[model samples]
Target: MTRTALVVRGGWDGHQPIEATDLFLPFLRDSGFEVTIEDSPEVYRDAERLAATDLILQSVTMSEISAEALTGLRAAVAAGTGLAGWHGGIADSYRNSSDYLQLVGGQFATHPSTHPDARHGEASDNFLDYTVEITDLGRTHEITRDIADFTLHTEQYWVLHDDLIDVLATTTHPVQPYHPWHRPIVSPAVWTRLWGEGRIFVATPGHSPEVLQDDNVRTIVERGLLWAARSE
Candidate 1:
């Protein structure tokens, strides 16, 4: 039987939600999924439809979510529908919904200032070169198995998370001259969690389509989608 995969996109254009999601479409089809695409979160309200889905790949970033939509999504996840996404699409969405925040396990905080002279409220020139170190746990995990640690030059996310989830990969940030920090900080670059019987997969590298196109990032994301759907 063919599995159903839903791709919900569209939000801040800066994240390139549509383009980022498009990069993975061919792969999802090639993997034998019957894909559905939606441009907004309203689809989450169709609980019956959501219940029938095998996976949800969302890319909504920094958007307001309605209580109804949020409830439908959280319910679907608890009912065993898989959830997966990368970067801001999944983790950085719903800025004020605590329920959504709890389900995602993290929120986008701030990255090191990329601009040498960035001022408050202005975009930071904070794209840093970083290495993602795959953990021993990830070496054998379905989503990250067989992939070696990789390096990326993009907006490395700094997020707030809990200890309930399993971290698959991590990155360490050395104190930058621009930020007021005296010590290095370690953050999860990839992680997975379980909500009821559902599987949740998240990767923090997809700040753009180019980041997702990186061989390592794409491979893991592809596998992550399948893994979340219980297809692997």
Candidate 2:
């Protein structure tokens, strides 16, 4: 059976939802999935449309989705449809909606910089080479099947997440003079969880278009989508 995907892209323009999603759409199509792109969250309200979809790729951030739309989406996932997203587009999206947060399983907090002034000045310059460490690798999961440890220059996410997430990769944040926290923190970079029979995959990279286009980042995301959409 040919799989179908709903690609919803619209929210904070800073995240470049439109441009970043454009990169992934062709990838999905080339992978043999029938793809549909929607700019509005209205599609979430259509139960029939959502129920027919095999996967949902959301790039929305910091926007409020209607309760009806939220309800329909939760129902679809619970009934075994897959959902996947990245960074603020998914993890930091719809802050007011606890229901959305509960489903996605994490919230983006802060990316403490090497220079405190990086946030106001040129934060992109502080985008250092960082490695995403494979944490729990014993499970024979398709997402991390042949994937090895990789490095990227992007905004590493410090997320507040649930224990239910099967953390596939993590990055350690060492306490530096700039950050006086004095604690070694491990942040989850990639993770997967099952919500009912449905699969959900989230990667906390892709802070910019360049990051999304990175070879390693692209490969991880591609595998993530496939893993999320995989059926028993």
Candidate 3:
């Protein structure tokens, strides 16, 4: 069967939604999907289109979606359309809509600066070396199995999430003398969620095109997209 995949991408040019999502176009096609691309979340309002979609790959970071559109999106997913995304594109999007946040399972809070002296607005402030430790569940989950702990120098998202999500991997923010945090803070680096009959996948590491190119990150994301699609 030819599964339909929809790519909704735009917002916050910093994340390079176009380029980042472009990286996976070939993979989606190779995976037997008939891919469609949209630059805004407005497409979510199309119930007929969404009903035919098997998966949704969203890359709009910090963007807004109308209440009606959000309703459509939630309904489609609940009816078995899969939703998957990486980094700020998914976690940081639609901040105004708590409904959207609830559907996604998490939200991006902050990426602490690498040093206290670093200026807040500088791009380099949030870039730091961090390790993603796979959870026991991750070792066995089809989306993350065979992946070992990996390190990266990029924006390490401190996400605000709930227990509803199944955490697959985690990254810890160590307490530094220069920072105010009293103890190490751990956050989910990769996770999945079940909503109705749908599957949702999220990864917090793809800050740039380079990060998406990492073998481990690339492999997990590719497999995740496939795993999230509506099952036969």
- The candidate scoring highest on TM-score is 3
Off by over 4 Å in 2: 117-120, 123-126, 230-232
Q: What are the lDDT figures for the candidates, one per model?
A: 0.88, 0.84, 0.95
Per-residue C-alpha lDDT of model 3 across residues 1-232, encoded as one tens digit per residue:
8999999999999999999999999999999999999999999999999999999999999978999999999999999999999999999999999999999898999998876677687788889999999999999999999999999999999999999999999999999887889999999999999999999999999999999999999998998999899997
Per-candidate TM-scores read 0.94, 0.93, 0.98
User: What's the residue-level lDDT of 212 in candidate 1?
Assistant: 91
Off by over 4 Å in 3: 118-121
Kindly give the number of clashing pairs for every candidate.
Answer: 3, 0, 0
- Give the alpha carbon lDDT tens digit for every residue of 13-74 in model 1: 98999899999989988988889999999899999999989999999998888899999999
Taking every candidate in turn, the Cα RMSD to the unseen true structure, in Å, is: 2.0, 1.9, 1.0
Candidate 3 has its poorest 10 consecutive residues by lDDT at 113-122
